[model samples]
Each structure stands twice: as structure tokens, then as C-alpha cells.
Target: MSDQTTNQQQSAAAMNEPLLSVRDLRVAFGTKKEPNEVIHGINFDVFPGETVAIVGESGSGKSTTMHAVINLLPGTGRVTDGSVQWNGRELVGIGRRDMETIRGREIGLVPQDPMSNLNPVWSVGFQVEEAIRANGLAKTKKEAKARAIEVLEQAGLQDAERRMRQYPHQFSGGMKQRALIGIGLSASPQLLIADEPTSALDVTVQRVVLDHLAKLTSELGTAVVFITHDLGLAAERAEKLIVMYKGNIVESGPSKEILQRPQHPYTKRLVAAAPSLASRRIGAEATMPAAPTSTFDVAALAEAEGHGSKPGEPVIEVENLRKVYKLRKGNFGSEDFVAVDGATFTIRKGETLALVGESGSGKSTIAKMVLQLEEPSGGSVRIAGKETAGMSSSELFELRSKLQPVFQDPYGSLDPLRNIGNTIMEPLNIHNVGDRESRKQRVLELLDQVSLPRELATRYPNELSGGQRQRVAVARGLALKPEILVLDEAVSALDVLVQAQILDLLAELQRDLGLTYLFITHDLAVVRLIADRVCVMQQGKIVEQATTEEVFENPQQEYTKNLLAAIPGASIELGIVEAGDHVPHTPVAGSGSAPFAGGGQAGAQA
Candidate 1:
């Protein structure tokens, strides 16, 4: 009875007051003489036990606004105006010492980029332990280490104990992100600020993370402010939604209202362009029509033409492709880790063959082998009918012009020092394809082809948004007019609208240039749309391979079916969560504590 009263008192106190209150918040960057303002006068109040989401495009100032709240703005940035109040106490201009105390204790932050936040030298476990100790959660190092494992386990890391010992360099992008999540929740603050925290995670992991948050919200009343470009996900997870555009809050209202009847033009465009909201896949008209076409319709007939002769021609073939890495297992008996195991698949000319799997599933390993970037331990990769295993240096150099790659991280793939125009022209220069003048002209033409503004030629890559940078990457990939393009998780990190645009652009290019694509991704929805065929991979092997229709309509394997069922917003179309829907869960070893949210109290309300 006493425990229940204490819980009631805590919940009542939290619900009675606004956890965070922001009004007319204005932030600025650049020199004093040349000032530039971002995040202009945004207002939002986050109460206890509620999840609020801020949705916008990359460089739309959504992230900047959040950074301003925590006073962690990058170079030359400062809060020029407005107020940020936590529990009626002014946070802006507060001394760093006091702010530090409040940061992890009252508000926990999960940064946007995991690679930037996690230290390369420290093990993930050490970082999580540090966060816990700093917050005064655990008394000793041993307790902190045990708590760290529990946190990682809750963040959906299957092998938390083993993974905790590994460093950041050893972990994949998704694994690193999950580790960050575990650290963020180590303190179990009153408020949790997640900025695209699960962007790197696959659909299933993403779902588990969100569901875990929902459970925390219900049990602990942990207010969450989720920042993301995924509008559909925001609508499904958040109660209140705020839309930002080019440094301004465009709209703020209930999530369902904003999604269904958006007041702003930008929000309307987002909803229309979001592929997850749409029932049918795009590009079906271009691929195959339901009925037959008339002979007199020249344009329609031209569109109706499939990869007629090119259907059987294999642009990329992998025969028993395998990649093995030697790993030292503690004392003795070193084990060979098989990254890719007999991953055989083919990409036909003018067709998109998608390799669908979660992180570390060897989809990327297979791509590397096909591109001749990585030497396979056991198999032969034939590119454009030529075996790549025994090709000479010059032969491989020549083969490069026939096959190009656009990697997932556009910023990393591109040189930041070079202007957008030069970045696109670098590939041409390397191949010695054309003269400087002609290359410049080709750059402009490619820019136009990708629908980017010609004015972006002078802009550096760091200045462009994620979508624009990816468009530039695509243009560079097309510079050589390669017969085949290997897109390695290219559009997975982008927003729905940007992803939709990229997909449409790729479709148009394939139609015009007859380009063959070896598309590697974990997104099954994208597979359903852009790919002609799908190959579902599990550990390091292909579990199922079939046409897009066959894979989606009737998935043969249980794993394939689970992948389809894991996508966000699919399970709940109504955009609402009911009571008792999410069962409370905690790590088995640390049963008393919640996995992600500091320590979940034992036998807490579900």
C-alpha cells in the first residue's frame, strides 16, 4: 500500500507539471558580422508521459532545434533568442556545471549520428558503464558492467555480453546505434530525446526499439521527443507532431490530424510521397500493365517494351561466392568467421535485383566481391560476362567503367573538400573519359538529369542535405554510363519522400539507359517497389529467391515472412496504441531493471 502511494505521488507530480517548455527559440551560426539564423521561434511543450515527434527533411533545422535545447550546437552556433525551461528552470545560458548535472539526470539525449558520438577507442560496454556511473545509477564498476549488459540486451542486441566486449570499429552501423541507445537510457532521465536513434536499425529492430519506448512511456512516464524524417513512423509512435521546414515550425497538432489533414503544403507533400502510407507500389505502370496495349500507341508501346532481349543476359553473376575472416578466439583454436557463404545470385541486364537482409547478413560482402573490391575466399564472380577473379590490373581498370557503385553513406563516399560539380567529375577524371570542358558540361547535364538545381555546382557536399548528396552520388555513378550499378544500401538512410524520389529517378534511368542494378538493402518495401526479383538472406546465405510478387504475396520461408511483418506502421494501420497492447519486458539476468531505460523497477506496471 505504501509503495503504491509513492508511485501515485511520483506519477501525479510528473503529470502535474510540464517536463520541458520551449517558446520562441531562435538559434544562430556564423561570425558576428555575418550572422545566419536557424530554428526561428519554435514553440512546443512536452508534458510527462507523452511522446512528441519533430519531422522534417535533412537540413530542415529539426536537429538544430533539439541541439539548441541541450546547448550542444556545433561550431559558431549560439542561441540568439527565446527560452528553454525544464521544470520552470531556465536551461539556456545556465552554467555548464549545473547543466551537466541536469543533462543526464533530467534529460537524456541520443544523438543523430552514432559514429560521431561513440568513442572509437572505448569498448561499447565501457561507454555504457561510464554513462551509468556519471548519472550515479550504479555504485561500483562491477555493478555498472552488469547493468551495461542488461541495457544492451534491452536495446535488442542478441549477444549483449559478447558484443559489449567489442569496440565501435568491430560493430556494424545498426549495432553501434543500438549501443548508443543503451547508453542513452542508462540514466533513465525524466525525458528522453532521440534524434533518428533507430535510423540505422532494420525494420524489426526499429519496431522493437519503438515498442520498448512505448512500454517505458506507459510504465515509467518517460517523456520522449523523437526527431526523425520518417513521417509515417512519427504518426504511428508520437502523440503530438511538429513539422519543420527550412528553419521554421510549419505545423503542430495531434499526429493523426496532421497526417490525415495536414495544414501545411510541405506536410501534404510528405504524406503524398510517403511510400509506406500508399497501398500499392509505384512503377507498376512502367514495369508491367494489367491489360495489353494497342499497336497504334507508339509512346505506350515504347513504355510497354520490357527488357526483351536483355532479360536473360546476366550483367552480374556470383557462383558460390564466399568470404571468410580469421578471428582470434581468446587463448587458442582460432576460428574462421564466414561472412558470406555460397551467396549465389544474378542480376540481369536492365533489372534491379535486391539482396534483402538485416545487418551483417553478407549482402554487402556479396556486393564487394561482385565489384572486385573484395577478394572472395572460395567463389568466382563474373561481371558483364567476364570473370573478375583472374582479371589483370588494366582489365579490372577497364571493367570499372562498365560497373560502378554508389555506397550507402553519401558524405563518406564523396569528398567533402571538393565542390558538388568536381565530386561528380572526379570519377570521369579517374577514368580519363573526357576533356575538362566536356566533363564540366557533362556535370551540368547530370545535375539536370538528377533534378538537382544547377546552382548546386559551386556548393560543397557538407552544405547539401542527405537527399541532395545522394542525388550527386547517383550522378557520379552514371558518369561512365555503366551497364551495371551496385547500390549498397544507398537509399535506406534517406526519408520516405527522398527515397521515393530516388526510386523514381532510378526507374526513369533504367528505362532510358537500360541500366542493371545490384541493389542491396534491408527494406522489404523498397524491394517490392524497385526490384524485379528478391533474394532473402539470413546469416550468410540466401534463404529464398523469387520474383517480387512471389516474395511479397506468398513468402515461402518463415524468416522472409517475419521480415515483411517487421516493417513499421504495417502492424498498426490506425495510428493508435491501445492499453495493454505492449507487454512489459526486461533482461533475464537483470530482471529487476528495464533494459534500455536505466533500470526498470521490478514488477512495474505494464
Candidate 2:
């Protein structure tokens, strides 16, 4: 037989068998005597060279199921029943030594949260080379170094050779994620499990990373098990979709079929909540009545009354905002780096003006200047017609009471040592807004406003889920009842359902309390949903500024156009009609409702 014929036969035979299979899998955590089952009887299969996606919100047991399959469950988690077979070999109850051998060499894993997964003390190249050497992919030290560089380059890291010596802290978030991908694929494993790999990345960088991953996996003929909470991304990348809800597979089918015609109520809610599907600002009337997905009333949320902004009344006026940093060059000389260059904008009394851009685009810097966290180089920030420049220390202190910030990483932003109640009350205590009893009452009320249970007040930050922690963060931001809330990538880290709930909460709060928002994010889909008007920033300059509809319907700037095109699942045919198409609403200057004119078809070819 010819070599080509032999290869073809081998490929054909391999297609008949599954690369990884799970049957009636059950996983539990805690003591054996008092076990808490998290993953109840789930089944799935991954064929060779196929891409499968498992999607669910946090605590839905999606990650647990994969961890059980690899026998690497955290803490006391273990597979109690059923089977996890790899190439027909049972993985349940496998010895640690045997499982370790199979882990990186046979089945690779790209974990979420690059900062926690990567060793901060070690160089990025060293980590990659270590994985290669451990898997015995390269024999010599020099060869391992070469292989590491090659893997990093393939994973889309620029200047791979020079970056090898840099530590994790030196690399950007996208770069850190790329390093993790390189390490995960260093051995060229047959099956790769990517757990929310691009969750934290911006749209453009996310597209680039996923494209490189797809290319590399295709070249190696490696099957991928992609896990995420993004339904649009799942539908776009995976051939098959498995929707898990509270430890059970609620729906499973072809990706497009599942997206177009979700049978389960949970799946239907997921599709409806995904911002990537279509662009429509929040608080707009629904064309069709939406089914109840959560405790919040979807219809009421959509039709929630807006807090009308006063004409010609600007609450925040940033005039020619400029922030320059001095970077130390060598030892003696310093270079001036302009972080925010002559940026200017205004936020009305009740409006959401989103500052959208990629990382290092100076949106956050502008936010800092607005909040008076950082002093501007050459500009003025006026709050309610009062200039903040040269303000007295006492006046700045009062300024902080009216302008509060809700940051990105809730856990990092929150004090781990404090209980939820105390955390929320800290702002009030520092500002001396109320007495002790009043502060306690204020904390409880804030929790209720954010839709968190009152019992959680006694719990610590670590005890709460990601979404819960964010709710707590919002409650803290609202404790002082600040006039303007500066949410900097606040909902970017949350899953779809939780993100929807947060948006709903923000809209409701805006209606009731008439709060103003300065939303900063790289997510154009989210910008479309929550922002009334958007300021597109690029390289420390505002590339475009217009209403959400105008920006999406007809982008004038190339950068703005590219941002719209980078949204994941922008090209997927959901087959269902969007409510935004039927309902046409006038764009209120600061009321936060506008029509979004785009489909989830961006970067489909990529």
C-alpha cells in the first residue's frame, strides 16, 4: 500500500471513534459522608478534529464536568459515578501518576484567568519551555527554548524572542493569555480544553487569538472542547453546542440549530440576553413580549421610564483633558508619554455616554481624571458648572461623595477582610453620611436595590460568586447615592445572564434615582445596548462621537467600523427576528434608549 493511502485509511478509521467521551458523569464536592453534588449525570462526546462547546452561567457545573474528566477537580471535588473515557480508556479513579502523564501530553487545558494560572515570578518563556520539557517534546535545553519561542509566535505574541525574558506582570492581559495558550499547546496535544479563554479580552484581540487557535488546532487536527458563557461565540465557533443549566444539560444539538431554535427555556433566555446577537439600547420597548427569564420583569425593564436630562445642562464637562506620564528611560532621561491627549466631552445630568475603545486607548485615564483620582496635565474638569481645577482639599473630598467608581475586578476592588455589609457601609462611614444604625439600614437597602439577598450581608467577598461580588460592588457604589456612577468595565467580566441582570438593574436605578453613568468599555455590543451616545477612542484621541444608532448604522471612522466588525458571532444567522428591528424609538439625548443597527455577523469569516 502507498503511504498516502495508509494515511487516508487511518484518518477514516479515527473518525469512527470519539476522542473523549463522558457517560452519566456525576461530580461532587466536600466530604464523602456529606457530599454536595454539583455535576449531576451529564453525557457528551468529542470526536477527533471536531469542535464542541459547553456553555452555562457560573455555578452551572460546566467547568466542574471538564475538571472531573481530567481528574483535576479543585479542593474535594471528585467524580462519584459514571465514566470518563479518553481514547476508550477509563479515566475515573485513575492513579495520579497515570493521569499526570495523560494531562498535558494527551489532553491540554487552557484555563481562564491568566494571572492566577501563570507564575508571576517566572519569565513567560521559562514557563512555556518548562511545559515543553515536562512533556518531553524537546530533548535539549536549547531545543526547548526554541520550541517555546515558536509556540509563543504561533499563539500570536509579537516579538516573541524579546518577550521570552519578560515576566507575567510586564505583559498585557492579551499577551498573558497568549502565553497561556502557547504553554497549553506546547506539546501539541490531541484534545484541547479551553475554559473561557477569551473572556477578559477585548473584541479585536479576542478575534485575533481565537483565529490563531483555530488555525493551530486545524493544522494539528486537534479536537477542541471550548467552554464559555457566550452563546454567540459558542454558536459561531463550535459545530456542536451543549447548554448546561444547574448541573444538567438542558439542550444539545448542532450549533446553528441550538442558536436558531433553542428548545429549553434557559437556552431561549440565553439567546435573548446575549448582547452580541443584535444591537438595541437598554430600556427600549420590546417589539414582542419576552418570557420571564428571571426575577426581574423583562417588559417593565425595557419600558422603564427614563430620567429625562435637562436641556443645555451638563453635569460633567471635561475640557481639553490631557494626562501625561513620565516614563524613566535608562536611568537619567525620562520620556513624556501622553496617556490622554486633549480629550473633551460632556455628560448631561441624566445620560449614559460610553467611552469605547481597546486596551491602552486612554478611556480609563479619562475616567480617572473625571473622578479626580488623577490630576490632569492641562485641562479642566467641571462638575455641575464648577471647575475642579485648583479645588481645595476639603472640596475634593466632597466631590468624591458625588462621583463614585465601580471598577472591573470586583474581588480585587473589594476588601476581602470585610463582610458584605461592612464593605457597603464603608463609604458611608468614611464620608460620615449617617449614624451607625442608619448606615446599617442603608446597607440593607442598597443590597435590596441591587437584588442580592439580605442574608449574604454576613458573608465575605470570597464566599460570593463573581456576579454576586459585582452586585456588592454596585451596592457600594450606590451607598453614597452618588449623582454620577463611573462604571469602568464593570459588567465585562460577567456571564450573559448576570450581565443582563446587571444592565437591567442599572436601567431601573437610573429610572428611579435618576443616576448618570460614565460607562467605559471595549465591548461595542454592550456599548450598543447600554450607551445612548458613544465616544470612540483610539490612541488617546476620540475617533468618533455620535448616537448609538448613528455609529452602528453608519460608522464614519475606520476605527469605529473595525470595532463593530470585531464583535463575535456578528455574522451568525440566528433565524429569529430581533425586537430592535420592529420597534423604532427616537434617541433621547441622555435617556439611554436608542436603536442599534447591526447583526451579530462581525468577524464570522475569521
Candidate 3:
């Protein structure tokens, strides 16, 4: 037989073996006094060489179920009922001694956040070596270190030898995730559980990481259980799809079948909300309720388009921007790291200009320069018409009032101690926008405008869901009534439904407020939905800039073309569920209503 045939035969043999089998899995968590049940009696199977994805919005029991498989339930959470068997060995009641032997040796986990999972104080190499040594993969510490480098290199981490000595803080988000994968595969585990592994990564970086993970797992015959909120990614990567809603398995089948003909309303809504699956804008009339009323007056927005006489000048303008960070190579020697070489873009009033690129592509650097956060080593940035190169402190402060940023990590951006109301009001208080009573009213109004319930105003940031927190972030951005809002991967971390809601909200706000948005993201698919123009960045320079449709349809640069091609699920053609089959367009979290009648898809807030 040919090599292909032989490989196929091996694959067939692997698939015949049941690697991990989960049956009637029931999980519960909360205080001992009030034991709350989540992950209601779910069942699934994983073959030795197959991939299965458990997908749903946050708190839909997807992650909770997967976490139960590995017996790693968080904070008082326990596998109350059902069986998690690996090769017929029970995982639920397994002894610590036995689970320890199996954890890194037979079952490995690539956690949700690489940054947090990795120890900040320790060197990356030390952590990798520890995993190898703990798994008995290497003989000596030196051998473990060498083996750790090999694993990282195998995981496609560049300069593995040198980077191994560096701390997790020194590595980029994508690189850190690669290192985590390296640690997960250090012992060549039979089963790998990845919990939304690349949710925080750039699109290109996500593809690269997932590709490397696939190649390594396939070569080692590792069965993968992927937990994610991204439906498009699940459709493209997993051979089998498991749709979960409110702790129940709503649907399970082949990925393509589930995508094309979803039986569950929750699944259909997820399929509808994913930007990569549909060509239309989020909450478009074709998908949503068509009412004979004023929803969002885009016609009036078009009429009041520009800020100037007839046409407005760009809200932000950059010319030949450059930022060089000098890195200390040795005791005396230093190396110049050029973050942004030459990036130029213009965002007109009421227009959204997206800066797209892989990590370290200078997108955020350009945003910082435009926000006046970073002093450019060379080049010029103009806000409205005034040059910001040598502006005074007061002038820069005034410029800040016109431009505000919404960060990728909303929780990190927000203060933990402050309540949501005070958090939003703090900005107004700092700016002294209005008196105390009026500012309180403004806070409540902003909450309503963002579609968040007013009752949540008294709650702290931790009490809110990820989507709600991001909405609060948007509310704070609007507190100053800024003309230009720099959204740095603002919606990337959210699930499809939440992401769609946020995007739609931004679009609506842009129309009503005539806001100028600088959307910085790596997801070209998202850019297609929200941005008017696209600027593709490479290294530290702008390689391509054109209308959003032009860049997606006809690209000039090979880099831009490759970036567009690398978008996850770009090839998966999802058949839109018929209008009759569609369900109510509910927000992702904090909504208890079922997507379908009696679907029992009501999930807790994330």
C-alpha cells in the first residue's frame, strides 16, 4: 500500500479505540449551603484520533463540562453524577496519586488563558522543564531543559533556545499560548483538552497556533476535546460538533451537518450571529424583525456626515509614524526594535478605519500614537487639524477628551473596587461634566443606551458578564463624548452573539453620535462587517490600505491576501437557516429567555 493508504489505515485503527468517553456527566458548584447544579447529564465520546468541539456562549456549561472531563472543576465545583472514563478508567473518583500520574502523562490540558496559566515570575524554560521532569520525560534537569526547547520549537515557537530563558511577561500573547501548548504536549499525552486556547489571539496567529496544534496532535494520535464559544472556529476545526445550551446537549453531530441544518434554535442563533458564517451585518433586517419604525436613523447620519462645511477632514491623520524600542541585549549592548516603521491612515468623521495585522504588526502602536499615549520616535500625528508632535501637556489633555480607547480586556481596563455606576461616573466626575445628580442620571441613561439593565448600576465590575463589562467600557468611552474612539480588539474576546451585539451597538452609536472609530483588530472577518476602510499592517509598516470591500475582494499585497485567506472558517460555506427556522435574537448573557419555544436554552450570565 502507498504511504497515504498506510496512514489512513493507522487512522482507522486509532478511531476504533475509545480514548475518552463521557457518560451522563452532571456537574455542580457553589457554596456547600447552596449547591447549584450546572452541566446537566451531558454525554459525549472522543475517539483516539478525532477532534470534538463543545461550543456555546459563556456560562452555557461548555467549559464546565470539558473541565469535568479532566477532573479540574473550579472552586467547589464537583462532578456529582456520571462517568468520565479514559480508556475505561474512571476519572471522576480517581485517586490523586493515579490522576497525577495520568494528568501530564496521559491527559494534558492547554488552559483558557496562557498568560494567567503561566507563572509570571518564572522563566518559560523553567516551566516547560518542570512539566517534562514531572512527567518523567527526561532524565536530568539539563536534559529536561533541552527537551523543553525542543517541545517549544516543535510547537512553532521561534527562537526557542533564547526565548526559553525569558519570563512569560516578555512573550507576546500568541507566543505565550504556543509555549503553553508546548508544555501541554511535553509528555505526548494521549488526550489534550484545550479550553478556548486561541480566543485572545490574532486571526493569523490563531490559524498558526491551531495548525501547529493539529499537526502535532495528529502525529502523536492525540484525541482533542476543544471548548470554545467561537462557532466558526468549531465548524472549521472540529470533525464533530456538540452544541450546549444551559448545561444541556442541545445538538450533537458532524460539524458540517450541524452548521448546515441545525436542529436547535440556540445553535441556529449562534450560526446566525457568527460574522464569518454570514455576509450581512449583525442584526440586519434580513435576520431581525422588520418594523415600520425608526430603529437607527442611518439616513439622517448620512445627511449629517461631515463635521466641516460640506466634507469633514479626517478625525485622525498619521504620516510616516515610527516607534523604536531599544532593547538591552547585554550589559552594554542594545538592539533597536522597530515597532512601527511607517503607518499612515485617515479616519474621517463618522467613519471606521480598521488597522489589521498579526501580533507585533504595529496596529496598537499606531493606536497609541493617535491617542497620544506613545511619543513617536519619528513622524507626525494630527488630531482634527492640530499637530500632536510637540503639543503641551494641557493641549494633549485636551486632545484626550476627543479620543478615548476601549481595550481588549475590559476587566483589566476597569477598576475592581468601583461599582459599575461609579466607574462610569468617575470619568464624568473627572471631567466635571455635570453636577452630582445630573451625572448620576447620565450614568443611568448611558446604561439604558448601552442596552444594559439599570439595576446593574450598583454592581461591581466582577458582578457583570464579559459582554456587560465591555458595554460599560463603551459607556465610559462615551462619557467624555469623544469624537474618536480607538477600539483595540474591543470585541475579539466576546462570543459570536455578544460580539455581534457589541458591533451592532457600535454601528448604531456611530450613526446617532456621528462618531469616528479607529477599530484595531486582527480579525479581517470582523473588519468586513464594521470597517469602512481597511489598513493591513506588516512588521511595523502599513502594507495595504483600501476600502473594506476592495481589500477583501481584490487585495494588492500578498500579505493582505494571505491574512484574508487565513481567516478561520473562510472556506466553510454555511447555509443560512431559513427565515422560518430562525429564532429570537437574544443577547448572549444576562438573558434568561429561551431562543426557541421550550428549548430550555436559558443560561446563566458569564
Q: Each model's RMSD to truth, in Å?
A: 12.0, 9.5, 6.6
What overall lDDT goes with each candidate model? 0.77, 0.77, 0.76
TM-scores for all candidates? 0.85, 0.82, 0.85
> Which candidate gets the maximum TM-score versus the true structure?
1
> Residue-wise lDDT of candidate 2 within 1-606, one digit each (tens)?
999999999989988899898999999987999999988899989998888999877667877789899987876788899999899899999999999999999999998666567888888888999999999999999999999999888777766887787677555455777888888888889999998777666777677777876776678878898888777678888999998887999889899898998767677767777886266877747332332233322233221222234644898898889988764444577667677898889888768999987665788788888888889999899987889988999888877877889976575688766777778878877776646656666666666666666766666775565667878888898777677899987886677877877787777666655778999987788887888889998878888989988998999998888888888889986644344343211121231212211211222111
Over 4 Å off, model 3 = 1-17, 95-97, 140-142, 165-170, 277-311, 419-421, 435-472, 582-606
lDDT of candidate 3 over 168-188, digit per residue (tens):
766655677788888988888
Better of 1 and 2 by lDDT: 2
Q: Residue 95 of candidate 3: its Cα lDDT?
A: 85
Better-scoring candidate (TM-score), 1 or 3 = 1
Instruction: In angstroms, give how far residue 398 of model 2 lies from its true place.
Output: 2.2
Candidate 1 — which residues are off by over 4 angstroms?
A: 1-13, 277-281, 284-311, 331-333, 451-455, 571-606
lDDT of 1 by residue, 394-468 (tens): 888777776889876675677766677777877777876556666666677677666677767766765676667
lDDT of 1 at 308: 34
- Order of candidates by TM-score, top first? 1, 3, 2
